[model samples]
Target: MPHPNQLISLLHLASPALPIGGFSYSQGLEAAIDSGFVTDAETAEVWIRDNLLHVQAHAEAPLWILLHRCWQSSDHAGVAAWNEWFHVSRETAELRLETEQMGWSLARLIAQMGWGDEGLRAALLAQSPVCLPTAFTAACVALGVDAREGLTAYCFSWLENQVAAALKTVPLGQVAGQRILYRLYPALQEAVAEAARRADSDPPMLSTFSPMLGVLSARHETQYSRLFRS
Candidate 1:
């Protein structure tokens, strides 16, 4: 079993109500549904799983691990570089805004909790945009969470938010959402492993090429009717 403090910190960081405004963005899931790509619970599960494997596992999860280590090692330049890379990799204006906005919100939350180091806080305040993964990694480090546990919590937090988005947009029942999350367990584990391996190497190149998702997100910017931010 994990240390009690670490487990509690993970739970706190992974909470859906973390006040980072994560609930507002579906990360293009709404657009996917609008285009008839993800309508039902099963389709939702498949869409999320594919993203988890192809996009997130390859990109953001690895970055999250890298940022976690940067925070641990006091590598401020690495943190800033990775944060900017993530911001630029966002395909659409809305996607970029979503990350920047959420990043700022999480940074503020850290400030409010008084868990932030002065240097990190100053860096975040000075920066025009801080990506969510960087802020979250900094938060985990401040809270004294280990990298493996922090990365797990980070992925799970994302999973929970996506599941909630599916429940609201796909109009899935609560039980169906729970079932989808349950089904994603294996993929989530694989993602954590992949991220760990990537983090062990020299910082890997960032890749955020999801053509279909890019199309959907771009279309979502002009969507006739929408329930999510992106």
Candidate 2:
């Protein structure tokens, strides 16, 4: 078990204020809003929650844990192999762009911050190869966060970014956004706990059946009416 400060470390890595530039990418929430899948406040709630559970929680959170393990073992080569899986397995262009760009940004930030940690640096060694969650969890490890805490924070940050974007693009009222977050709290908690429990297992796996969302994100690249970078 980790010390209490481990939780603080995780929180720092997943903060909305983190230099990873996560706020700049809506993860296609903008496209979903355009397509009416996220027209209203309630729908926004569903979209964020569903996307987290089906996509980020399942698909990326496990990888965050895996990357954390890799960092712990100082296995930069293994980290690269996993990043290869992350890059090619991304189903669409926007998804690929989101991960790739954020990964590079995080790598750059690590250099500027002079984190001075070889393991963290190794995990994101390649420019275009590292995944977002991998980079995120790397910061957590550098700060002494536990692997499970890192995974939960990684998953939660996805939901936070979506809901925050919806507040701006949909112009959802503050009360409405808070309500949606509250409604998602239970599921979010369960997913986080589940992620923590499974952190040490064989590559963490989550569902990835959001092809329509993927299509919207890809379409967003050329979208003449974009409110978010995607």
Candidate 3:
């Protein structure tokens, strides 16, 4: 059984209300909407699902697990290297800025609240522009969150945010949003499982190549009108 405190911490970390500014960014989904790639609930679900499966499953989830292990063992150098790797993996300026901004926000929040020991907290803040997964895994390690459970929470948070973005951008009804989220449950589970396998591979591999996301994000930079930043 997991500790109640750890469970609570996971919930706290995953909450959209965690003050990390996750709600303000559509992560290229808005651009996709602009391009008519995600006009209705069905298309919206497909767009979000594809990225969740292809980009996040291959990249962020497994990298998250590795970062978690690094934090668990107090490997600051390893943590820093992976953090930079994530920064470079972002294929667009908007995407890169999104992770850096969210990561910095979470790092500041955690440090202010004294979530970790002094030394660890100092090291986290030292990363300057820490990526989201690095700061998030650091929080998980500090709070005793199980690695697998943390990955689930991470992916779920992302799924919820994407669905929420779709609701606003695609202008879908509440029920439609729920339905999309409901249908993604299995894909989410598969993503978490794949992340575990990749993380445990003889030599872990991490890569994210969502070309449409890059193109859309770049176009969003000059989009005449937009709701979300990215």
lDDT tens digits, residue span 51-123, model 3: 9899899989999999999888888999999999899888889999999999999999989888878877987
144-204 in candidate 2: lDDT tens per residue? Answer: 7777666667777777788889999987988998888778878787776655555555545
Segments of candidate 3 deviating more than 4 angstroms: none
What digit string (tens of lDDT, one per residue) describes model 1 on residues 1-230? 54468888888889987889999999999999999999899999999999988888888998998888888888888888888888989999999999899999988888888885888777666656888998999998888888888888888888888999999988899999999999999999998888777667764744787999899999999999999999
Work out how many backbone clashes candidate 3 has.
Answer: 0
| lDDT of the structure predicted as candidate 1 | 0.87
- C-alpha RMSD by candidate, in order: 1.6, 2.3, 1.0
Q: What is the C-alpha lDDT of each candidate?
A: 0.87, 0.74, 0.91
lDDT at position 54, candidate 3: 91
Question: What is the descending TM-score order?
Answer: 3, 1, 2
- Candidate 3, residue 145: Cα displacement in angstroms equals 0.4
Q: Which has the better TM-score: candidate 2, or candidate 3?
A: 3
Off by over 4 Å in 2: 1-4, 194-207
Which pairs of residues have clashing backbones in candidate 1? none
